[model samples]
Target: MDVRISVIIPIYNVERYIRECLQSVARQSFSAYEVLMVDDGSTDQSGRIAQEYADRYSRFRLIHKENGGLSSARNAGLEQAKGMYVCFVDADDYITEDYLCRLYEKAEETNADMVIADYREVEEQGNIIVKELGQPPRQGCMDRRQLLQALTSVGECHYATTVVVAWNKLIRREIMCRHFFPEGRLHEDEYVIMPLLLECGHVEWIEEVVYLYRQRQGSIMQSAETAMRHLEVLQTYQNRIALCRQLQEPELLQAFKRAYFWNIEIWYYLMRTRYGVESSRLYGVFSRRMWGALLRYHHVFGRRKTMEYVIFAISPEYYLNQYFK
Candidate 1:
C-alpha cells in the first residue's frame, strides 16, 4: 500500500515525553501514514518506549543511530521515507488527532507542494500561552513573492509565526528530499525553510492548530547555548541576502537587508542577557558593520527610518533600553 504521509520524528533523550508524542501520532485521525522514529543514540528510556510503539503499531518503524544532532537524525528519517508527503515532529512535541488529516486534505485540495498549519506553545503543565500561525493573516495559496515578504517581515512575524520551523508544515517528499538539514548546527531550520518554500511552485497556509510545541527547561531554545548558537543566524541571513541579490529580486533584497539589521539587535540582546556579555563590547563590534549596512541599503530605510537606525547606531544601549523598555 502506498503511504500518503511519512511522519519523521527525531528522538533523543525525551523519555519524559516520548509516549505522549507517539500516542498522539498513533491516534491520528489520518491512517494512510507511516511514522519514522529515528532514534539518535538515546541513553534514556526514550528508545525503549519508541520501540514498544514500533512493536505494537504496524506502521511505526524505529531506526537507531549514533549521537548525531537533531538535524542528522532528521536527515536519516528522510533517507528512509517513502511517502508522497513528509511531516517533521519533534520527539518532545505532539500534535492534534486531526493534524495529518487537515494538512493532507489542504495539500490535495490545492495541489500545493507545501501546506503549513497553525501551532501553539504549551507549558509543561499544558497551559496554553497563545496560538500561532505559520503564515499569519494570510490564508489559501501563496505566490513566491508573498512567501518572501512573510519570510523577511519585521518583529513577531518572523519566528513568532513559526514560519521558520519545519515541523508545523507538510512538505512534498520530492521537494524535501532535494535539501537536507545542516548537520550539527543550530538554526538548521532557518537554513532549510527558505530554500524549501522557494522550490515549491504552490504553497499554502491553513488556520487549524495542528502541532503542540512544548516549552521546557532543557530544550534547545531555552538553553544558555542558544545565545552563542544564535550567531549562526548571521550566516543564514547573509546567504539569503546573497540569493535575493543574485536573483535580481530588488524587493526581496530590500526586505532581507531590513531583516538583517533587525537581527543585529536580536543578537545583541541575547548576547548581553544570556551570555552575561556587556553591551559596550558588543556595540563596538556591531556598530561598524551596521553603519556599513545602513549606507549600502540607505534606499530601503529612507530618511526617517535611516535616522532612527543612525540614532540606534550612535547609542544602541540607550535606544534599546529607553524606547524598547
Candidate 2:
C-alpha cells in the first residue's frame, strides 16, 4: 500500500515522553502513514523505546545515528521519507488523533504543497494556551504570493514559531526534498521555514489545534543556555536576510527584518536578566554584529524607530526587568 504521509520524529533523551508520542501516532485516525523515529544517539533509553515501537508496529521504523543535533536528525528522516506528505513531531510532543487526517484533507482539498494548523502551548508551569486561529481567505487555490503575505503579516505562517510549532503542519515531501534543512544550527526552523514556503508556492491554514507541545523545565528553550543560543539565532536571521536579498523577495526581506529585530530585542533582554553584565566570549562579538545587521537592514527600523531608540538607550537589565517581570 502506498503511504500518504510520513511522520518523522527525532528522538533524543525523551524516554519519559516518547511513549506518549508514539501512542499518539498509533492512535492517529489516518492509517496511510508511516512513522519514522530517528534516534539521534540518545545516551538514555530513548533509542530502546523507539526500537520497541518499531517491533510492535509494522508501520513504525527506527533509524539510529551518531548524535548530530536536531537538524541533522530531521535531515536524516527527510532523506528516508517515502510518502506524498511529510510531518515533523518532536519526541516530547504528541499530536491529535485526527491530526494527519485533517492536515492531509486540507492539502488535498486546496491542492496545496503544505497545510498548517493552529496549536496550543503547554506551559511548564501554567495552563495550556491556544494561539489565535487564523482563517485563510480561500479554501482552495491559495496562491504563493497570498500565502507568503498571510504568513509574514500574521507572523511565520509556516508554523515555525514555538507557539505555532513545526509539528502541527503537513508538507509535501517534494517541497522538503527540494530544500534541505540547514544542519548544525540551533534555530534551524528560522533558516528552513521561509525558503520552504517560497518554494512550495501554496499553503493552507487549518484553524484547528493538532499538536500538544509539552513544555518542560529541562527543555532547551527554558534552559539558562537559551541566552547563549540566542546569539546563534541572531546570526541565523542575519544569514536569512542575505538569502532573501539574493532571492530579491522584497516582502520576505522586510518580514525577515521585522522578525530579526524583535528577536534581537528579546535576546538582549534575556542576556541581561539571565547572564547579567558578565561578559561572555561571544558577548562583544554578538553585540557588535547585531547592531551592524540592524543597520544593514535599515528599512525595517522605520516602523519601529522608537523601539530601536529605546533598545539603544536603556541598559539590558532595565528592559529585562520591565518586560520579563
Candidate 3:
C-alpha cells in the first residue's frame, strides 16, 4: 500500500496546542502513515506552525483553507487522503506514540472495518490526570447490530463514549469518504458515526489506550448545557432514534428512546434554572420544542423514567432546592 493510514488533524485557533498535537503524530511508531493537518483559516500561528512541520517531515502534509468549522477542515483532509484507513485527531488533542501502530495492527489482524480503543482525559493545566475512559467496544470483532447495541447502550450498562465520538477509531477510507462530514454543524459526529457503523461488517476492539484528550476550560463540551449547543445535541439524538427506525431495529429504537428521555429531562432541568437563563429567546424556543417532544415521545419512557423526567421537567426549582440540595 502506498499509504496504509491517513491521520487527520483539523486546525482552527489551536496554536497553543497544535505543536504538541503534530509532534505526537510525528512520533507515532507506525511508519506508513501520513498526517493531514488541515488548517481552517486559523488567525493564529497554527497554520504556520503546521507548515513548518510539513516542511520538515515528508509524512506531514499541510492544507490551508478559508475559515470553515472543524467538520469542513476534516472533510478537506479526507478529500485529499490517499490511505487505506483514516483516523481523526482533534487539533487540541494528540495521541500516544504507538496509537496508530496498535490500531492499524488490530485492523489488519482482525480484518475489521473499524478498530476502536480506549483514551485518557487530562486537565490542560499541570498536565494533571483527571481520569481514564475505558469505554469498551467489547473485545473482538462485532457485527453491525452488535456495534449498534454497544453504541446505544441498548442492553449494556451505559453508552460507549467511543461510539458517538469521531476520534478513537480507525475507519476504512472507502467508507469514510462515502460519508462526508456535515458542514457548519456543532456536533458533527452525531450525523455520521452510527451510519458508518451500520455499514461496517466488523469492528475490532482493543484495550490499549491510544489517545490523550485534553479537557480545556472553554471547550464546547463544557458549555453545551448552557449554550444553544444543547439544542444541537437533542437534534442529534433524535436523528439517532430516526436512524434506529430506518434500520428496523426495534430493540435499538426502544433503547434510544430511553436515552432520549433522560437527555430531555436534563435539558429541561438546565433550561428551567440558572444556566439556561442567559439567552432568553433561545431558552423559550428550546423549552417549547422540548415540551412538545416530551409529550410525543412520552411512551418511550417507562413509568419510573417518566416520573423521573416529570419531576424535573415540571419543577426544576423544587428539585434543585430539595432533591439536588
Candidate 4:
C-alpha cells in the first residue's frame, strides 16, 4: 500500500499506555498511513503488546532491536519508513483522531516541508494545560529566517522556543532523513530541529492542539539518573551557534545566542542544586568561553534577563544565589 504518512512510535516499557496510544492511531480518520512500532528492547509487555497489534493490523509493523535510547529507536523506525511525510509519537502519549489528518492537510495545502501543531499537556492529576507552542499569527507559513526567529522567541515556553519538540511536528520524509537526533541524548529535539528547519523552505504552524503530551512522574525525563541531561544541552546550544555561523545569518545568530544564554541559566540552576558535579563541569567550560559568549550575545543584554547573564558570566554561584535566587 502507498503510505502518505508514517507514524513512528518509539516504545520502551510503556505497557500501561501503549494500547491507548495505538488506539488513538486506530481512531484516525485518515488512511494510507503506516505505523512503525519501534519496540526498543522493552522488557515489559510493551514489546509483546505491540506485536499483537502487528498481528491484527496490516498497517502496523514491529521492529525489534537492542535497547537503544529514544533517538536510536526513532532512527530505526525512520530507516524503514516508506512514506511521503513522517511524524513521531511517544508510546505513552495519545493523539486526537484528527492529529495526523490535520498536520498532513497543512503540509499538503502549503507544500510546506515542515508543519507544527500545538499540543495539550495532560498531567497525572487529570489536569490539562493547552500550550500554544508556536509563535503568533500561527496559521501562516514561515521562511528560513522567520522559522529561526520563531524558534528563538523570548518566552517561558512556546512553539520553537523552549517547545522545540519533535513529536508535534510533521516533516517531509526527505527532509527528515537528511538529519537525525543524536543517539543517547536528552533534549535531542533541540539539536535536530534547527538544522532541519534551516534546510526546509517553509514551515506551517497551525494553532490546533492535536496532540496529548502525557506528563507522568515515572517517565525517564523525571528520573533522577537523567537529571544531568540538562548538562548535555550546553553542547546543543553551542552547536546551534555553529549552525547559525555556518549559514552567515547575523540576525539568526543573534536570536540563537539569546536562546543559548538560557542554557547558561539552566547550568546555574543545576549548580545551585545537588547536581553540582555536572553543573561544575559545564561551569568550567563556560568559564573558558565566558568572554566569547559575552561578545557573541552582547547585543541581547538590552533585555533585563540577559543583563543578569552578564553577571552570570562572572560567577555561577553568585548568579545562582542572588539574581536567580
Which candidate leads in lDDT? 1
For all predicted structures, in order, the TM-scores are: 0.89, 0.81, 0.86, 0.87
- When sorted by lDDT, best at the front, the candidate numbers are 1, 4, 3, 2
The sequence of per-residue lDDT tens digits that candidate 1 reaches over residues 45-126 is 9999999999999999999999999999999999999999999999888999999999999999989999988788888866
Cα lDDT of model 1 overall? 0.83
Model 4, residue 57: distance off in Å is 0.9
Q: Model 1: runs farther than 4 Å from truth? A: 131-135, 158-160, 218-226, 280-285, 303-319, 322-325
Clash pairs, candidate 2, are: none
Q: Model 3, residue 242: what's the lDDT? A: 83
The whole-model C-alpha lDDT of candidate 3 against the native structure comes to 0.77
- TM-score ranking, high to low: 1, 4, 3, 2
lDDT of 3 by residue, 148-249 (tens): 765554211323666667888999999999889898777788788888887888888877667877888755434434465555767777778888889887
Best by TM-score: 1
Give the Å shift of residue 9 in candidate 1: 0.3
lDDT for 36 in candidate 1 is: 98
lDDT of 1 at 208: 69
C-alpha lDDT (0 to 100) for residue 295 of candidate 4: 78
Clashes of 1: 0
- Taking every candidate in turn, the Cα RMSD to the unseen true structure, in Å, is 2.8, 4.0, 3.4, 3.2
